[model samples]
Target: MIKGYKTQIMDYYEKIRYHERKALQERKDNIKREHPEILDLENEIGRLSIKLSMDILRHGNADDVVSKTREAITDLRVQKAELLVAYGYGQDYLSMHYQCSKCNDTGYIGTKRCSCFDRYLVKLYYKSSELAESIKTNNFNTFNLDFYSPRSDGSEKFSPRDNIEQILSYIKNDYIPNFKNHSVNMLFYGDPGTGKTFMTQCIAKELLDKGFLVIYKTSDELNKDLRTITFDNDKALEESLINCDLLIIDDLGAEQITDFSVTNFFTFLNKKLIKNKKMLISTNLLLSDLTKSYTERITSRLFGNFRLQKFYTEDIRIQKKSLRQNRFSEKTILNQ
Candidate 1:
């Protein structure tokens, strides 16, 4: 999906190997100068290792002889290690280092891509998607329950604070910890500025931090991406949407409701649901109006596959702006 990203990662691995080999050579030169005896022992170890390989190839040699040769080489290696430590150098001082020892700084382990490579790709995705900066301010640690009222209204069973506390508990304690095990998707519907998008962002940050490939797009942004997939035939972008760990679509009804938009929306959601890729959708539209708002096929897939939750609270944007104004007033009074 990203331009020249594979080449960039390959270059990173090449640089790692180059620097490590250079460092190893400097360490070897130091050893050769100060501890020539240790260097001589290392040469002997190399010679014996070559002999062991040759003897293993020689079918004429018995197993006992090969075993004896390996034991002697091991003794010399241990002795050399002891001398190096005694002289204040680490035992591995002459060895080349790897950033990711599993893949030895290469993006792949054998033929398959390594977990470290996935992390790098995720980093690039987050950086490009603007999620890295967004999560810095909107994560779980920055979330505040004080904005929600503790007093219950007659329309709901509990206070906004109580309901949100329950929702947050389920998301943080249960859902997030068992994200991999559970195949459930989520639907967050609420009044605008009632913390629907904020909670969705919180989940995004949590999952992304755990190394999940999370793609966040507003409904309008997704509409444009779908257009690109249709017009440009971007297979990588399509694969990313269909195969990511989680796809978060915010403001479901904000896009222009054309026939094309409705059709593409249903198709994308249906594909993800069928493939078992998790998704979280947040919308300002009422849950009851969903049938009226969307096509029958879209609503059917949503109600069947998604675990729907309704957010309830006064506008958090208003509350936060008010809080900021109060802080400014307090600061001014203090200065006076």
Candidate 2:
């Protein structure tokens, strides 16, 4: 990926140079054609200087010729400046100008990368993630607790809505204080339709916006990609996953586990734990389900590292439908 980015920058630099050269030549030609009077004055000055030097060389007493040459040079300089002002360029027209002045159209600076190159890498990275919609649609700003019911009359008096709101508040505050560093690994375990994936994506978007490298992948999709890994670059994906600022493993336990997958996952988790990188896991598996499906060792490691947020209640889909119907009925009555 890094090599590809470098090549891309080189290609961009070549294109920029091509266009700038064309523009500079066009500017020079246009000046000579459109301002013929200035060009004529410059040519006359050069001729006079050459003639005066020849005269001095032919006859050693040519002081008057030298004085005339000096006056002609000064007047030509003034004409050149006026011509530059008429055209929208300064007298330094020979200087190469670049759209990206930091790089001088060369997409790199010294041994390091240029600002435009860095921005290109960033854009490429985001494109590879392929989650622009997820980033745009899910964030702290779009998340609203008002959509959830606040009634405390169910079997669990303070409902799932209240529980999730508290979790949201804690997450917001946690990100504010420790987003730059000291972030805790989180395991959002719950039943389906309880907002586990939504919150995970929201957190991913927030971290990504703050310029963190966050890789978000579902277990099933990731497992499919892992199957194609060659003997070489075995560590490439693993390194990216473990070394990124945040790794979000969503829909865990949804993939059919193979030996290669199990081994790779264990290795990934172990390396990330050793490095203390934040890993956020969101799954529909409860602690009991996790212990039964995966080994106790994996479960122990997860519990030891992650702050568990267990979501429990009636499914949110049913609640959303009921709430929509209620709002519709109220609207009809108001119209009547």
Candidate 3:
């Protein structure tokens, strides 16, 4: 999973570095404005720190001067920390912060990858292969409305094609264009092979191309993550799930049903919804059937918070397979 994402991981580290650098500068500016005396002490410490290095390298400079310069810088730093604490700030308020202090948000310690990078790779591994290859052909450009018949079979008011067109229109004009400001959580519910997951992948690729972090996990994988978060205390997995631009949970009813799964899942789902994070759920279960699998409270939240979209079409995989077989038969007859 990490094989194709080396550049992306490095780019993430670069963003962290840029953010930390800018934040340090902002803190410095605030300190200078609020307390000039402390800022002056900080400046003197910086000068002596540089002078200590120069004295150590100078040929005629004695060791005594270097040691005294080092001591003076240390004493000034202690005073600065005391002042920051006295002024209702952390002792290390003026210091820079790093997401990964071991690597200083660089993703590597010297030449080797850091533990944080490995954790990122683990999260990436949960992404389904169906999604990984969906970008090449399953996007909006390749979505074929022709596969859905235009004629209504009396199942509902509109034909499959008309229904799908309405969904795609909302996706294109309303959802993707104004993703940030106009985010709406969606529940894509349907039986198997109804193109629910494919459309979800299409949206995933679209947002990812627009520079958003989209995390995809099947129900099983999400349960596994929740278990790890509950027992193993995996903060990285929890953070990724909560903070991704859009989280797509495919096949939501397939995970093993247990007390732990139900408890943790409801808690996780509520947290994300309360935070107003964008999410997409594709479930084979109907809205009414969800009560059999999950608590009524969970179903109510899903129905209340998420915009429901029902998918109904012939099994696309089977349709494609039959078409391929018909083509092969025609080719054989022509050859014979």
lDDT of 1 by residue, 191-228 (tens): 99999888988999999889898989888988988988
Error of 1 at 42 (Å): 4.5
lDDT tens readout by residue for model 2, 45-139: 77877887787787665587776667778887787777777777787673467888888877668976666765555566666665667767767
In model 2, residue pairs whose N, Cα or C atoms come closer than 3 Å (at least 3 residues apart or on different chains), thus clashing, are: none
Candidate 2 regions exceeding 4 Å error are 1-118, 128-130, 151-158, 230-239, 323-336
What clash count goes with each model?
Answer: 0, 0, 0
**Residue 278, model 3: Cα distance from true site in angstroms:** 1.1
Leading candidate by TM-score: 1
- Show pairs that collide, candidate 3: none
Model 3 superposed RMSD (Cα): 12.8
What TM-score do all the candidates reach, one by one? 0.80, 0.65, 0.66
User: Among these predicted structures, which one has the highest lDDT?
Assistant: 1
TM-score for candidate 1, residues paired by index: 0.80
